[model samples]
Target: MVFRIRPIIGDSFKRKERIGNRRARFSSLLALSKFDFEEEHEMNKQLDVHTDTESGLSGELNAAISRRRLLAAIGMSGAGMAAGALMSGGIGLAAPRGSVTEMVYGLSADCGSCVVPATIAELRVMTGTVTGTAFYVTDSGQEGHFYYDPGDTSSPDDTGLVLVSTAGYRFKRIYEGPVHVKWFGAKGDGSSDDTAAIQAAINGLAGGGVAFLPSSTYIVSSTVSIPYPNVKIMGSGSSTVIKAAAASNYETMISASGLSGIEIADLVVDANKANRTGLTVRTVAILLASCTDSSVDNCIVQNTIGGGGIPGVGIALGGVSVRCKVTGCILKDCGVAGKAADGVYTSGTQNLIMNCIALNCTDTGFVIEKSSLSGIIGCTAKQCGAGAAITNASAADVTGNFIDGLTIYDWSASNTGGIQIGTPNASLGALLNTRVSNVTMERVAGSGPSVYARQQGGKIIGLTLENIRINGAGTQGILFNATDILIANCHIYNTTNAGIQSQGACERVVIEGCYIYGGSFGIALTTGCTGCHIVGNVMIGITGQTNYGVYCFGTGTNINCIMNTIENVTVRKIGYDAGTLPNVFSSVNAGISTNATATATALGTLSRKFQIFDKDGGSIGFIPVYSTIT
Candidate 1:
């Protein structure tokens, strides 16, 4: 009778017990009192028990005598009541009779030999490789299939089991199944058509499915062709509306070309535009052309109908659309009057327009054309005609935007700024490496320029405007004509003109930590400004009809606005309300108004550590002026 079952540590049955020295510990009551079984079934039918040799009784004493005759035919007196009847009645495979009957047949004393699945359909046919601390499935009919890890005792025999199924889980297969655009006959009842039944249920989605748009109003009459690839067009949030019957033959009421893993969430794209009166062309409610990795979350692109005179874009990520995303969307009243409506339009490249909201647009309420490394975070543009328009973009990142009331349309005398960038005609290009941070423009009434940077035909290199906050600017509240520009920590107020104006042909300009009030020149650099660095600025209440808290001009014959550096500037109550007598520094020409000691030979390398005050705290000392004017 062969019997070899050694590895036992705790729960010692004391079979003459001598383990550590390797050997002796096998006596499940002397191997079930010497099990015989028809003389070992006639000596195992004349030996050769499939040749792993040593037969006759060495299948570990015939697996402890067939688990003591199946625990004495189920009366269960041993092997821990036959492993509590195979773990509360899911009794099936049984062979363990040692190591405390292999921990009652669920085998997992810290993964010594791993095989623990009492049920959940035997943990889904028990495969392997499961780690610790995260395994759930309490069998409400195998709820979302078994998952394992209870502090995984590592030994899934080297990475094997993968059985993970989600998204309407069924496990082992049926991975992503749920297409329902009313099961392909889509009649969300706002009129019927349902655009070929929601484009044939998004072309019968098979790759990572989910077309579902169930809560009503989907009368789409025309364009609805989401090409393909990993589609997901879920809705029901804003009651799933997708109106827009035929607003002029449809330039786009929902179109996704080229293709990439697309997604259009919680829908509502009305684009009714009062029924496109006469009709012409240019229209859009949601158009992603030449798409790539798309997404349009919490969607709602409103009334876009600018036909004939064209111009309506209410969400357009143009051809060249790459890395797209338009979050928490809501673009209103798209375009009407002379039609140039833009409420979220991107020429596309590394796109992302976060927390979106663009209202009353006719032109520019977020339009980053000719994109490159794009971004417009925490967005909101109101009463638009221009509230974020970055043309010929490059490395753009307009942050924390909140522009207001910028609709000064007289058919374009140019700069309708609440934030408008380049292209007066350098052949239309160049907004290079831009960044306008923490932007906030308020009450900006007509004439425009609450931030306008122009460099006719390319050259706004490495521009930056930080922590900006402007209130009531009708003209020039920060208008620069680029070249390595940087205006830091700005807070301009009540500007009628020049609260910050660095004219064209500018170079290496840097206006630091500003806070100007009632502008008519609280900082102006003209005649082709050169290497300027006006530091630590703070000019208060200069109501003296605007003269200067810092104004540098040159061209009294070729100094070409020399190297300027005005330091530690602090000009207070300058002419205090038209009483006239406040000039901290003004060097003009051709209508002459000179003082910097008569323009100090055209002022180059003029470094003034300035301080001019009034309103009863009189102090004016500005004599540190260096010269290098050529």
Candidate 2:
């Protein structure tokens, strides 16, 4: 059917034919635009539509009415009353407020389903239903669309929609792109000071964004501070270098202080230790202070000098930082000082240091101090003064680390070891519940042990050392002064002192399933040890030396070493060869001495009886009652 639309007061009428199989279509004469209705049954017939020049229509313009008569009939009396009655049925001719029927203009081809709303309320209703669908807004002085999802309405202040646009969409919100350091006037020419320019670029990113560094060397005179949350500073792997201009002035090259959700990746930080002319204080390459959920990955930190009564550190995470990670980074020549220069030092709770390498550090390659529930995994420490140090830490796991060629620089007997766990001061508290597993140490040449655990001020409790291999250590292979400690599944060889030694007051220590060879003593318990269980251990003595398989002795004072059980231990080639090693088990003390000089009357009251056995499980003799111990 042909539909005729005429204004109630004007004499102009427009007739338009409906499309095939379509009943009627609504075209508003007020805007002179036609709306192709998809659902024709939803539209109401006999509705009085009003235009801009007319008040209302009296009668509907059907097939029987001409164009001029239709306008004249609508201009008769009672037209407004009839139109009011028709609008009372909720069939108001004007489209719902802000609903559009025209094509949106100036939209790109990639902008899908451009929705141009005449009012904001129409846009809000459309956005609520179009969840996960992107739309472009055009012809409304806006450049982008309002992206919406119902799940984002969890916050009371959230509008469930975010307006992303570059040309200042709704309320003049400009989209923030990546903030490059070069855009902020940073000259990365390896000469000028780009510290201020780099800092400005990071500061300009208010609510956190990427601060990209190009492939150029940036000379920084002072420490660059990353104070913003959720900010990432990315660089071109090793090509982008951040070198310290003055090494002695700053404590760290980059400092992330009290910030969370920060990431620093693919950068090289150089401390310039060789160029230290007026260097005074020690330096750290990267310092993460009280930062949580932060990461430093694929970065290189090198040449940190620690001298003149100062300790240098390559990377330090202190101030109780939580859940931070440092992975896939290389640290070299970190500690120039011979004592306290540590490559990666962490005192943060629940932090992770993995897949990192520390080369030629003076003091220690990695250190976990006063941190609880932290982990050091899959790291390599080579040619370091000490491989790793764990002190005053609880519930920490040190696993899968390869420590090789640990040497002594200044030659302090107390401070040299491949892996050392000691409480040097009382302020650091006790070290408890620490586990070391699958750690291999080779060529540990120093005046100290391969693995040393000493109690200077604090005691160690619940320590576990498992699956460890120590080859070629200068002094003792493993030394401990701990309570409730377990050392199992270990292979120790070529040590100057005993393979495993326990000094001081050690209680409830278990050493089982260990193989020891080439040491002065296989297992030695000295200085008042109690309730130690040495079971299922094999000790093989090297030729051309006097070595004891198991040695247990007490101090010359009143402290007695008692209640020690040694069972299923195999001792081979001690005195069987041409060496002058006395016995397999050497018990020398005032009370339990097996020496022939002690009189029978002196041994009767003080000495306790111990059964000695041969290789064929035959009872050889008793200690202090008979001459032979084993």
Candidate 3:
């Protein structure tokens, strides 16, 4: 009875195995490749005698010399150091799949990346409880993203740093504390002096904080109000920039009256000089009067003297600032004298402007006269001249703004009109309940699918427009006069004319779930339009090109092109392609009788059931949504 299997240089042993009677298994092998010393080294060196009937030939010569030394050490495998020690020994690496991978765990991928790995948990400092987790990269390219641990110890006292990003990161903190002001660079032409270091940080604030501007180039002058209350005047992110001095004078680089929880992140504010009317002029780059809880996120606000014209007001919020919030701000070129420049001139009332962005402005990209229940969300305006987006004398609550090119009043030197509500000198009367009522435009962006009302008898009631998307290759999405409208789920594409065009006098109107593809004329309802309701909308046609999806002219009465859906809409009942002639009180009921025989061989006409719908609602196929009309 003997047992032995050797190749143990500097011996080491431990063994156990059974199989049929219940238990079995043990393991150990360090260095034995060379195909197990040229194949099993003589049956593991003849397993020299040991006992229990040599334990089955010493366990089959120690398992064929550890399976030929693990297939000759699989070409010397180290498998990423055994997968970094089973991912730092949590065994087979599993956790981290949600909550932004359990709050940004590992994989340094490069510079300054840490999610706690003991430098004493990377500088831990918590009074009692320690609920730790962290993350924030959010497109961390351009050498940006950097968090502080400094070996934690609660980052130096008083329960400070509380970073909780992870909602895909929106960290633009731009300084939470510690950075006692000191930057001197771009003065020469940009203008310096910092007015005695901004009046010695507003008289050495004993309460409110922040006033950092590191990267330089800050030529400011005058109206820089700092009447305390959670003050902030930061920079550095856009690499610290602020230039305001184009002479014509009406100064205001930064102003805040009797502040209340304020904020003005990052920085830029270059009001391009030379008659830059109110360069950073006394109302707003970041102004909040009777301040409640203010904010002006990100930052840009440009117009540094271009055509000796930027009187195009940029940010002017007057007294009684309510929940003011201007997110992701950026206003460009601004009103080069074309007339009343405004990139944001509010009167503050329930203010909340989201994702703000405006380009080439002359007189509009957010200019609410006497702001009421304000809320202009998701804004963007390109080219812009007269009106790329406005609401004169109050009725503010324009939703999702995105105006495009905008040619301007067709060819009358001064006229852009893409979103203007009320103002032919307002006051159609009702004074106490005030003027300009509930205005809501969802998914808004227009060029054509129009809605331009000039007060004669002002009262825009409740205008709720869902999905009001217009591209305007031609014009008209919702153009009105004396309006009271409701346009639903609209999507007006291409266009040359008529998607929803009313001349004046529009009441109780509702155009539903629309989609007016390629227009030349889709829904015109002209002539003192009243009681309009065109439901489940959809209008197409643009191939060989011809128009008219729902056309009504002068002297309208309860205009209802009901439960609609027009595919190639070319039934121009009397005018349009064949010149112009047919115009009596147009009327059409439920449709699709070849649109009443193409309106009787082109307006020598006939009418009955005009373009069908309502087999139980919902069928916005062709697409012209006057707010889901039905």
Best by lDDT: 2
**Clash pairs detected, candidate 1:** 131-152, 132-149, 132-151, 132-152, 133-149, 133-151, 280-308, 426-456, 426-457
Estimated TM-score per prediction? 0.31, 0.61, 0.30
Give me the candidate number with maximum TM-score. 2
Clash number by candidate, in order:
9, 0, 73
* Residue-by-residue lDDT tens digits, candidate 3, 448-495: 334465454345555555555655533565666545566677676765
> Global CA lDDT of candidate 2, please?
0.60
Error of 1 at 530 (Å): 5.1
**What lDDT score goes with residue 527 in model 3?**
63
Ranking of all predicted structures according to lDDT, beginning with the best and ending with the worst: 2, 1, 3
Q: Please list the Cα RMSD from the true structure of every candidate, rounded to 1 decimal place.
A: 22.0, 17.6, 25.3
> For residues 386-478, what per-residue lDDT tens digits would candidate 2 score against the true structure?
778777633333222222222222222346477877676655367777788888878734577888888777777778888888887778889
Winner by TM-score between candidate 3 and candidate 1: 1
Candidate 1 residue runs with Cα over 4 Å from true position: 1-223, 228-253, 259-285, 291-313, 322-342, 349-364, 369-382, 391-417, 420-449, 452-476, 479-497, 502-522, 525-630
